[model samples]
Target chain A: DARVTQTPRHKVTEMGQEVTMRCQPILGHNTVFWYRQTMMQGLELLAYFRNRAPLDDSGMPKDRFSAEMPDATLATLKIQPSEPRDSAVYFCASGLTADGKGAADTQYFGPGTRLTVL
Target chain B: DQQVKQNSPSLSVQEGRISILNCDYTNSMFDYFLWYKKYPAEGPTFLISISSIKDKNEDGRFTVFLNKSAKHLSLHIVPSQPGDSAVYFCASGYKAAGNKLTFGGGTRVLVKP
Candidate 1:
């Protein structure tokens, strides 16, 4: 079964430290998305890429967060000078790049990286 | 502002009973809706989806009903089982745009045997 995979299932870092989370999307999927989940905000999309190109990063904090897809399979999200407020589960999802399927097309998600910034 | 809303924070159902979860949206631009289920320490997984053109779609025990006029959608799980317990999230998306899902606060469901 093809599954989206994320590395470092858990992380604990000091405030002001840099944190990087990595993801390996399912093979053949061309679209990638990064999301943050917290008790207060629920699920928020930070950024996404299509065909290894950044499509939108409007929801992300520009000063502290960055998302990139180095290649089709590897996608990364990084936070510099991470603050305690950045603590949340970061999820990566993959989907088809084409939209001809309409609403039927769906995204497959990874297990997620749980980051705790102190 | 939250475009999608799941008012109930949690729902409880007994085995062999039907559990219905509802979601409402404010944006008419949202032409598609999806349901996702999540367990602790894991990301949300796609459960089911329905388009604005269709009123209902079903897969096994799970069924989704959409009412475009009311801007509402619901998920029905018949014969709820212990394994069915989890947090369910409702998401909406605009068909013209790429699949960037706008999700609602999830509802935690508990199934008792």
Candidate 2:
């Protein structure tokens, strides 16, 4: 059974500290997405990449948050000077997309990293 | 604005009974809808999905009904079991977009034996 693997299942950091969450998508999947889930906001997409190239990062906070797929296997979401408001569960999802079409998008999600910023 | 809405925060059902979870959307552009089930500390898993072109889709004990005109959709689980107790989320995607799913606030389903 293939699954998306996420590192550091739980994290606790002081405010203004740097936090980095990593994900290893399924081997053959080509698309990866980063999402944040909180009690207030539910689930919100922060960014996504296709073929290691970022397709959109509009939902991400430009000043403090960054998401990147350095290679096919590794994807990371980093926050500098993280705030308490950034405390949420971050999930990474992978999907197989041969074409650019939306019809082929079927995402398989990771277990998620729970972050608590004090 | 909440594009997708699940009005009920939770639902309770008896074992061997039917559980119906409803979702409504305000966006007329949404063409594809999906249902996901999530347990505590676990990621949401895909359950059932329906396209705007179809009214109903069924798989095993699960079924999804879509009402395009009303912009509503529902998930039905027959013979609800203890294992089926989880949070269910409704998501919708636009056909021309990148399939970035906009999700609704989930409804927690409790099954009692």
Candidate 3:
């Protein structure tokens, strides 16, 4: 069975440290999404890429957070000088779209990376 | 402003009973809705989905009902099992947008055996 895989299932870093989370989307999936889950905010989309191209990152903090799909197989989210408020579970999800399947498509998520910034 | 809202933060139900989770949305652009279930320490998984054109969709023990006029949707799980304890999230999105969803605050359900 195909699944999305995320590295660093757990991370504890001091504030102001740079944290990088990696995700390997299921092979053959064309779209990748990055989401953050927090107690106060619930689950929110940070950014997403379609076919290795950045589609939208409006929900992400451009000053400190950056999401990129260096290639089709690898998608990365990096936070420079990460702060305490950045502590949350970061989830990477992949889905098959681009064929106009739009709303009918379902996203397959990876075991999220739990980030704890002190 | 949260376009999608799950008013109930938690629900408790006995095993073999019916569990209902409701979600309401304020976005008129959303023509499609979906439900996702998340277990502790795990990512949310797709549960069920319904389009504005359809009033209801059913799969196995899970049923999703959509009310476009009321801008509401609900998920029904019959004969709930202990394993059904998890967080359920309701999401809405536009058909024109490809797979990007606006999610509501999840409801934590506890199924007592």
Candidate 4:
């Protein structure tokens, strides 16, 4: 019954404040992903990591957003100078692709962190 | 531009009926497609997936059909139940693209009991 776990299930912050969201991927899962879900844009991939290494962060806004996996079990997404537009439910997902498996084959998601910038 | 799209914003179906959700992708390079179900306040969960090499895949009451030529795919749920009500998202990606998944705007399904 292992599942991805995200902390601070709900966050309310003022504009220009810094926010950090954390996730603990399922044990032994080798890949991690961060996504933002908004009413206007639906769900967007913000960043991803494989084997504790960042593979792509192109979807993330470099100026204000940063994602890192300090270790296999812990991953974090930080937003500096958070704005109202940055308010959205952030999700963390993890999967195993150790044996030449397709990256999108399967993923398990954690209960998302709902961020609100007022 | 959105690479994956789910045109229908919402769908209503009677219990015991069949619910069909459609998805389309613009990327010809996409070789894998997946369907996920999300409840309010919860993260999306993987439901079913199909490979471009195969036209269809079925698990229990859930079935996914893929038409490569049309660049379209669909999820069919037979004997739909109240628990099946949720927002359904379709995602697509290619093997070469790594683990990043491009998700479509979800289609919310309401099953009336």
Candidate 5:
């Protein structure tokens, strides 16, 4: 089965450290998304890419968080000078852009990377 | 503001019984809704979905009911099995709004076999 793959299923890092999470979207999928899930905030969209170009990153912390799709198969989410508040399960999802439009997007999520910031 | 809400944090149901999970949304622009099931340490898996144009949609043992007027939708799993025990999340989306899904906090369902 074609599935989104994520790296470092679990990670523990100290505050102020740099954390990087990688994802391999399902082959042929054209859109990728990054999300953060916490007990208090639920699920929040951190960033998204369409055709390997960022469509939105408004939900991310502009100063410390960045997301990129270095190639068709790889997408990455990075946090610099990470803080305790950044500790959460980060999920990566990919979907096909139906009919060349943004409609009918059905996302399939990866196993998610659990980040623990001490 | 939380656009989607799953008020019940958890529920328990006997095997072979019907398990109903409810969700409500405050966003009037949402045109599509979906249900997802998640196991511990796993990503949410797609369960079922309903569009605003239709009040009901079904797939096998799962059914999704939508009440657009009330901004509420529900997932019904008939003849619940032990494998149905998982966290359920409700997500809402607007096709015109880039299809970005807004998800609820999720409800944990336990099926006693």
Candidate 6:
């Protein structure tokens, strides 16, 4: 019955505002991923962390976006000076491990945070 | 430069029929492939997966077929029910490349009952 949980399921903000999305991964999962979904681009990997350490973030924009996993249970993605193009659904997923060693072998997703920047 | 592609934007099928969703990939190194189903306002949920070494894997009514030579894979749902209506996304990843999945734009399936 364990599942990933995300807060601020819906967010509406003006352009140039700052937006922060939070995720609580499933207990005992060692890998976490952040993705952005848009009609044009589909699901794009923003960043990912294994054992609370970021392993890849090349998919993310360097100027105003950042992702962090401060602890085992929490992962956060922030967008400073958000623009209209940043409006999309942000998803958080967790797996048991980075590689297949301890992983359940599949990523479980949260309800996702829908962000609308005007 | 989309690594994965689901060409069909949407499909409509009658209930009790078979639903076939197709996906093609450009990355030859993609060793893992997955299919996910998404409803409006909800996150995409993992439906099934197949490794590059295998050509087919099935769970209940769902089956995934991979053709490495063609770099194509497919998901087939038999006796499709009304509940099977959702957006289906195709994703591929290379385990050696950090396991970050590259997703397609998704195909919306409407099973009319």
Candidate number of the best lDDT? 4
For model 6, residues B1-113, the per-residue Cα lDDT tens digits are 98899999999999999999999999898888999999999999999999888999999999999999999999999989999999999988876666578889999999999
Task: Give lDDT tens digits, candidate 2, residues B3-113.
Answer: 999999999999999999999999998888999999999999888888888999999889999999899999999979999999999999875656578889999999999
Worst 10 residues of 1 chain A by lDDT: A97-106
Q: Model 6, B105: alpha-carbon shift in Å? A: 1.1
What lDDT tens digits, residue by residue, belong to model 4 across residues B1-113? Answer: 99999999999999999999999999999998999999999999999999899999999999999999999999999989999999999999888877778999999999999
lDDT of prediction 5: 0.92
Q: All models: lDDT? A: 0.91, 0.91, 0.93, 0.94, 0.92, 0.92
lDDT by residue (tens digit), candidate 5, B13-87: 999999999999999999889998999999988888888999999999999999999999999999899999999
After the best TM-score superposition of candidate 3, give how far the Cα of residue A64 lies from its true spot, in angstroms: 0.5
Worst 10 residues of 4 chain A by lDDT: A97-106
Stretch of 10 with least lDDT, candidate 2 chain A: A97-106
Backbone atom clashes (below 3 Å) for every candidate: 0, 0, 0, 0, 0, 0
Interface RMSD of 1: 2.4
Q: Native-contact recovery for every candidate?
A: 0.48, 0.43, 0.67, 0.72, 0.49, 0.44
Worst 10 residues of 5 chain A by lDDT: A97-106
Candidate 5 docking band: medium
DockQ of each: 0.58, 0.61, 0.69, 0.72, 0.67, 0.54
Error of 2 at B98 (Å): 1.9
Per-candidate TM equals 0.97, 0.96, 0.97, 0.97, 0.97, 0.96
- Give candidate 5 regions above 4 Å deviation: none
- Estimate, for each residue in A4-115, the C-alpha lDDT of model 2 and write its tens digit: 9998899999999999999999998888999999997888989978888898898899999999998999999999989999999999999876575555356788999999
Per-residue lDDT of A1-118 in model 4, one digit per residue for the tens?
9999999999999999999999999999889999999999999999989899989999999999999999999999999999999999999999888464445568889999999999
Candidate 3 per-residue lDDT over residues A1-118, each given as its tens digit: 8999999999999999999999999999988999999999999999978888888899999999999998899999999989999999999999988574454367889999999999
Where model 2 places Cα greater than 4 Å from the true spot, the runs are none
Q: How big a share of the true inter-chain contacts is recovered in candidate 2?
A: 0.43
Q: Rank order by DockQ, top first?
A: 4, 3, 5, 2, 1, 6
Per-model TM-score (chain A alone) = 0.94, 0.95, 0.95, 0.96, 0.98, 0.94
| Candidate 6 residue B95 C-alpha distance from true site, Å | 1.7
lDDT of each residue in A1-118, candidate 6, tens digit only: 9999999999999999999999999999888999999988889999988888898899999899999999999999999989999999999999865554433257899999999999
